[model samples]
Target: MLKKIGFVGLGTVGKHMAENLAKSDYALTVWDEDAEAAAALGKLGVKVGSSAKETAKGQDLVIVIVPESEQIVFGAEGVLEGIDPGTIFVDMGTHCPETIERMSKEAVKRRAMFLEAPVWGSKEHAANGLLTILAGGDEALLGRCREPFSYFGLNIIHIGKVGDATRMKMIVNMLQAELLVSLSEGLVMGNKMGFTPDKILEVLDSGGVASPLFHSKGRSIARGDFSRNLALKYVHSQLERVLEAAQKFGLELPAAETARKLYAQADADGRGEEDFSAIIKLLRR
Candidate 1:
């Protein structure tokens, strides 16, 4: 039944996912480097573990959704320390395929089952329990976890196995980075040509290129609200992963490379914590 669950990492979307889990019937335990983040979950009856290891200890399932893979595994006081054999581990973060493969190997070494289900959605979707889960691992394991997963995921898709979900997530976010940059340039260009941002959005919405992303982020940028939904730095990191993978496959992604540089420049200017739509500020400059 995968009844008992331990969750590590309480960043942006992770916090919301854990919150949904705590609200569910599963016995949930959570931990994070930030005491305050873990404390919030405690209010909802989630047991706050002292560390990642402490959380994973004795739990049937352990989910790690941190920004980096290594820190939660082989890092100091990491989750691997607490993981018992037969525990099913799921990582729902965007990371390089190489890193995901390494984590899978480490999980196998510990005699635990592994799944990489990097989540795809904004903070709003996570908050509303509508995040899409791109899962990659054993099909039987996914079926075992479906009940708990349904508590937070709107769509639970099995992409393939091991590093597969990570690869998909890279492409998803690479296109996201490109799309946002393109939208930003359009808004900036249209605004400079004396069209209101709203008008530009209205026109785009009336056309074939219109999408949900365009509507939501376009309005947010129009309102000048760059509040962090998905951190720009993370998107930038995903682009790096995409480029790294591309380099290995000998694929030249000109658009992704150019978009990564824009995100990099924005990150350097101290806008890393802002929403990805906030890259328009860099484009505006």
Candidate 2:
């Protein structure tokens, strides 16, 4: 039920979310470092702001979807600079928990409410308005923003404090990477056994062991289609964080580590911008 929403960062996920919000009744303004991105959103009836400071000025709510956490909090004229006190700020970027806490404290000091609502799912899900949102901060605040959040996400989960949503988002992304890489390896192994990947998928589809992921990415991976819906490099970064978290807990996560290496190998092969299914490219190579 926000009157005005200012958004920063309109990359793959941010752009579509902003588009959906623009189609709504809320007055929307957006700013991105890329001029082309700003112009693109402008076409959707969104007012393109000149700077991050200008974007946040006098807005009831502000959203930051930049990739790098630094850009969201402390980049040149970051969100903290121009957002008015008492305005609700929601960050949908995947940032470190400590960093999110620090930024949240600063926002609180300025009398603004900060919510970390990092999302799960890729660009395809964003475009489909089916992404799963992991929201953190006050429950009442999340309730107030539910309508705007639902404009672009189907599943909205309110986790814990200001940074818990980011941690949960990383966990989900880590699992997604592991599952995708495992699916890629399984397809490669099936191919080696003289089984066509399509045939394997047919058999797996009818069993309880199969998942939507296997049927979706499985076909693309088998066909070696490494397009850029979900970039392999971003998944690799999530895996790195997962591994570090696991080590901190003294837990053994061998499968996740192996999957991380495959994603890293795929990224190293210059398939960084390709879909997570591109891990199959590394396996087949």
Candidate 3:
């Protein structure tokens, strides 16, 4: 029953999520550093707030989806400054678990609730309201926010308490990075061995290893079209975080480490803003 919503961050995926929320019965107010992005949402009946703090005031719920944790949680005009007591704040960005835990503690001190609810899937999924939400924090707070989540999330999994969702997301991204690298390597090997990319895709699709990710990204890879479904730089950042988390537990992820290098290479080559699938370019070279 959390009706009044304050939404921050209007990036590639965040804008679509805010648009979905606007379609719901809730009253929505949004703020972003990009005036054009905020103005675009204004046409859809979403009120534009001058700052993050201004957006949080009077809101029953505040949702943040920025690229970094500090952008929404820290600063003079941050969400924390304007959030009223009893307001539930959901951060749906992939960030450091330790950072999320620290922010959660701060929210509690202010009598506000904070939930880490990072999502799975790309911009396309956000646009279609089919993203999978991995939630952490109190179950009761999650229950109260379920209605708004339904607008943009097809599946909502409550992983555990605060910080757990971020840990899970890092693990998920670790596997995802490995898979993309494997796909690229396989395609490169196939091309070098006189096999067509389409043939390789067809064979993979006919096997148990086939997945929605492979099918969608595979087609894009075959056509040499890596047009930014998910940015390569962000995927690289996630891989770095995953490795950091693994190192903290005295474990090493060799495959993820390898994939991370390839992504890093892609970013260094000025393809950072391209689709993560663009890592295939490294293999192609």
Candidate 4:
């Protein structure tokens, strides 16, 4: 059991994940780009560190959740540069799969264990300790980390080697974007056809198409509450990556592309910080 754990990145998801780990009695040493974010976690009894190296020093495990792959490995005081030789470093951010592989190889060369462990679900799910985790690394290592992951995740799956979890996370997020796009179009089209969103949701709830994703955000849409939960800017970036990868494989994804365009439009309209369901505003207009 890795006892002293260090965390880098304190975004919406990372904050809650660290809080869960802290609540589980892990001796947490943490750092974040935002000093106030670190202070907030420090108030929770976590040791707030000034830099990633300080966070990593002597910790059995180091976890990173930065926005990009490069930062995960080579940012100012990144996890790779700071983690101890024998410590396990888990990359939980959604990032490029190739980057995951390259970083893992480099970490191994430095005698550190590296694992890709991207999570699925929003900040709410993270706060509730219900996110689903997809992990890729040595199977034995993944098994060793499962108990801690279980404290904050509903399920944890060991997919394959180093880059596999990033790929899996992309696929998962792409499907989520697709569903959001389709549901947004359906709701707007229903409203245009003289049916209230509530009526359409009533039908959807009774139909085979109903799901928690739809029920949760659909209710938000029906209630006209489009505040940020998952931002459109993040979704747009992930869709761009998905498209680039799909193009490399010679696949045409019209629906995904359409969804990508809607996100881009929403970004242009300054709704990038708004929930993904806010894409309906463009359609409804």
Candidate 5:
């Protein structure tokens, strides 16, 4: 029954998700720091808000997706400033569970509902509406957002209460980062053994280790196309968050720690802006 939507953040993934949402029956208002990003959505008949506050005003739901954890959501001019009581605020960006917990408190103070529904998958999955949504909060609240979510999510999983979705997202990102690093090492060893990257991919595709992730990333990495589907810097940051959480729980993740160092080296080498799979370039060296 939530028909009006306020969407903030129109970066690489957000823009496409908003574009898809615009196709639905909901009345959509969008805002972003980037005027050009907002303009593109405006051209699609989606109302463009002059500010985050304006976008959030008079909406059934205010959705935020951005890099920063606190400022972009609860800052002076952020969505919290314009959200009406009873309006739901859903954060779809990946962030640490601690940050999300702080945000939940602020939403409670304002008498507004908060739900953390960080997504899994990357830019292409977002564009195609195949992204999986890991939702955390009241199940009834999640059910209300389900229709709008369907506009951009192929899978919607209810993941416990307010902070659980972010924790799950970090866990998923950790595995994704580790697997990509593992693949990078495999491709590197194959190259050193005088096999082509494509040939290595062919053999991997035929084996027990085969996966859609390996197939997609391996082919793009083979073609030397490191265009950004998921930025390496974000992946590195996620791994860092995962390790930090692991330490808090008195756990050790040897593979993730090593993968973070490799990703860190690539980030330091100025490959942070490239696709996450570009870490293979570091292994090649």
Candidate 6:
């Protein structure tokens, strides 16, 4: 029944998620560093707050979906500063588990509830309210927030307790990175072997290895359209986090390490802001 919502972060996907929330019956107050972004949300009948602390103050629920963990937990005028005791704070961003654990401890100290609920999907999915949400925290707390989540999430899965969502996101992203790389390699090799890009896509799509990602992104890659869906830079960051987590457990991921290098090359080539499918461009070069 927590209807008062304070949302921070208004980036590509976050903005759409916030918009879906604004459409709900819940009263929403939002803040972002980008004034233009905040203004856009304000036009949707969402009350715009001047800062993160101001946004969190007196709200029954605070949701953050930023790129970096520091911005939410330790940045100037962060959410931690103004959230009232007993308010629930949910982070639906992909970040380091350790950072989220630290934030969870700080939330407990403030007598506030915290949940890590990283999501999976592109900006298109977010815009259409089809994103899959992986939540990690007290199940009771998640139950309290389920209705609001239904506005934007097609699936709300309880992964475990705090930090588990982040770990799950890393695992998912690692596989995503590898899959994209494998697709890129296959396309490039087929092209070199005299098969047209369209032919390659047709073969892949008609086969068992086909997926929604391959269907959408493969067509785009074949057509040389690298417009941003999930940016290469963010994928590269996730790969780094995955490798870091693997190392902590004395594990080796040779495929992920190789794919990370390709993504790094794409970023260096000024394709960081482009779709992750642009890694195919690196292979072509």
Q: Write the per-residue lDDT of candidate 5 for residues 68-116, one digit (tens) a residue.
A: 6455677777888888888999989888877788778878888889999
Give TM per candidate.
Answer: 0.97, 0.95, 0.97, 0.96, 0.97, 0.96
Give the per-residue lDDT digits (tens) of candidate 6, residues 1-285.
787999999988899999999989999999888999999999999899988988999999999999885765566689999989999999888888778888899899999999989989998999999999999989999999899998899999999988888988998999998999988888889988999878888888888998888788888887888888899999999999999989999999999999999998889989899999989988887
RMSD of each: 1.1, 1.5, 1.1, 1.4, 1.1, 1.3
Q: What TM-score does candidate 3 reach?
A: 0.97
In model 6, the clashing pairs are none
* Candidate 3: residue 227 Cα off by (Å): 1.4
lDDT against the true structure, per candidate, is 0.90, 0.84, 0.91, 0.86, 0.90, 0.90
Q: Candidate 3, residues 79-146: lDDT per residue as tens digits?
A: 99899899998999998877798779878888998999999998899999999999999998899988
Model 2 TM-score, 2 decimals: 0.95
Better structure of 4 and 6 per TM-score: 6
**What 10-residue stretch in candidate 2 is worst by lDDT?**
67-76
Off by over 4 Å in 2: none
lDDT digits (tens) for residues 1-285 of candidate 1: 678999998999999999989888889999998999999889998799988888988989999999875666667689887899999999888777777888889889999999999999998998899999999999999998888888889999999978888888888999999999999999999988999999999999999999999999999999989999999998888898899889999999999999999999999999999998999999887
- Answer with 1 or 2, whichever has the higher lDDT: 1
Least accurate 10 contiguous residues by lDDT in model 1: 67-76
Error of 1 at 196 (Å): 1.1
